[model samples]
Target: AQTVTQSQPEMSVQEAETVTLSCTYDTSENNYYLFWYKQPPSRQMILVIRQEAYKQQNATENRFSVNFQKAAKSFSLKISDSQLGDTAMYFCASARGNKLVFGAGTILRVKS
Candidate 1:
């Protein structure tokens, strides 16, 4: 079984600053996929970034990036130059089959 863990329950960042959300997982499989999904107040899950276990380099999307530690089973998300629109509940997830296992989620509040 694969399980994702987000240590920080809540995070706050000032607009134009940077924030990093920590996440860790436990998995025995060698191949899998990790993802960070952001859900705003509207409750829409949006893909923030994704990283493949086989890939050595981290993934980046606009202001979002990931630090994937395969051996440690850790995958963290970094949001640079955070904006007000970035305020949302960030969830870390792992997917292998049709279903995805998600963490409890970290509430990110961006102050303008």
Candidate 2:
């Protein structure tokens, strides 16, 4: 079984600022992938970053970085230099082979 939780349901950030979105996951599988997905208003879901359960290094994509703590089962995303274009619904997901579980999501509004 796999489950994900996002403690913050909504978040706001100023332009050119930084924000962090936290996600915690629980999984019984030894090999799994943790991911942060973003879906803008009426837009398709896009991959923000991903971390393998077996990896010790966190994943980073441009201004987006993930703090993955395997022992604590925490995967948090830090967005630097946030822009209005960054406003979206961010989801924390965990996949164990064929099963995928998504968090309730955190809506991020980037204001000017």
Candidate 3:
């Protein structure tokens, strides 16, 4: 069975700073997708970024980016210049075909 693990249950970062959330996954599928999702107070699952297992380059979008280490089975999210809006529950997910597995989530608090 595929599993995603987020060792940090909660984290905090000052406004305008950067924060990196750690995530590791185990899967048997050679072709898969790793994703980082941010869920704010509204409970909306927002797609931050994603990386294809076959791709060597990391995925980035604005202040959000991912450090994907395929060989290590690790995919982490880096939030640069984190704003108050970035404070939320960040979940790392892995998808293979129709099945998806998510981490326990890391609650991020942006301190002002």
Candidate 4:
């Protein structure tokens, strides 16, 4: 069984700054994909970034990047130059064999 853990329940970042959200998971599968999905007040799951377990290079998209430590089974999200639009509930998810397991979620509030 795979499980994702997000220790932070809530986080706040100042506009134009940076913020990092932590996530860790336990799994036995060797080939899998990790993802960070953002759900705003509208409640839609938006794909932020994804990393394959076999890929050593971290995944990045614009100001969003991930610190994926395969050995430690840790995957964290870093948002640079934060903006108010970035405020949302971020969820860490693990996918394999058509099944996706998600963490509780972390609420990110960007303040000006």
Candidate 5:
């Protein structure tokens, strides 16, 4: 069984600052995928970033980046220059086959 874990239940960042949300997972399968999904107050699950298990390089999209430590089974999301719009529930997910498992999620509140 693969389980995603986000130790931080809530986090807040000042506008234009940076914040990193920690995540770790336990999985037996070597081939899998990790993802970060953001759900705003509207409740839409939007994909933030993704990293394949076999890939050594971390993935980044605009102001979002990931610190993928395959050996430690850790995948963390870093948001640079955070904005009010970035405030949302960030969930860490793992996918294998057709199933996706998500963490409890961390509520990020960006203050202006």
Candidate 6:
């Protein structure tokens, strides 16, 4: 069985600062993809970043980036200069074969 874990249930950041959210997963497969999805108040999950087990370089998308430590089975997200619009519930997900599993998630609130 595969599992994802987000230890922090909630996190807060002041506007214009960077914040990093932690994620970890357990998997036996050597090849797979890890993802971070963000869901806002409206309840829609958005893909923030992704990393492949075969890739050594981390994935980045604008202000969103991931630090993927495959050996430790860890994948964390870094939000740069977070804005009010960045407030959302973030979920860590893993996909292998035909199965996709997600973590409990972490709610991120950006203060003004």
Q: Between 4 and 5, whose TM-score is larger?
A: 4
Residue-level error in angstroms, candidate 4, position 39 = 0.3
lDDT of each: 0.94, 0.93, 0.94, 0.96, 0.96, 0.94
What stretches of model 3 exceed 4 Å from their correct place?
none
Clashes counted in candidate 2 amount to 0
Best of the candidates, TM-score: 4
Question: What order do candidates take by lDDT, descending?
Answer: 4, 5, 6, 3, 1, 2
All models, RMSD in angstroms: 0.8, 0.9, 0.6, 0.6, 0.7, 0.7
TM-score of 1: 0.96
TM-score of each: 0.96, 0.95, 0.97, 0.98, 0.98, 0.97
Worst ten-residue run, lDDT, model 6?
A: 91-100
Worst 10 residues of 4 by lDDT: 93-102
Alpha-carbon RMSD, candidate 4: 0.6
- Candidate 4 residue spans exceeding 4 A from truth: none
Give the per-residue lDDT of model 6 (tens digit) for 16-81: 999999999999998999999999999988888888899999999999999999999999999999
Query: Which lDDT value does model 1 have at 39?
Result: 99
Q: Model 2, 1-112: lDDT tens per residue?
A: 5679999999999999999999999987777898999999978999989888898888889999999998898999999999999999999999978767999999999999
For model 1, how does the per-residue alpha-carbon lDDT over 1-112 read when each residue is reduced to its tens digit? Answer: 7788999999999999999999998877788999999999999999989999999999999999999989889999999999999999999999857678999999999998
* Pairs that clash in candidate 4: none
Better of 1 and 2 by lDDT: 1
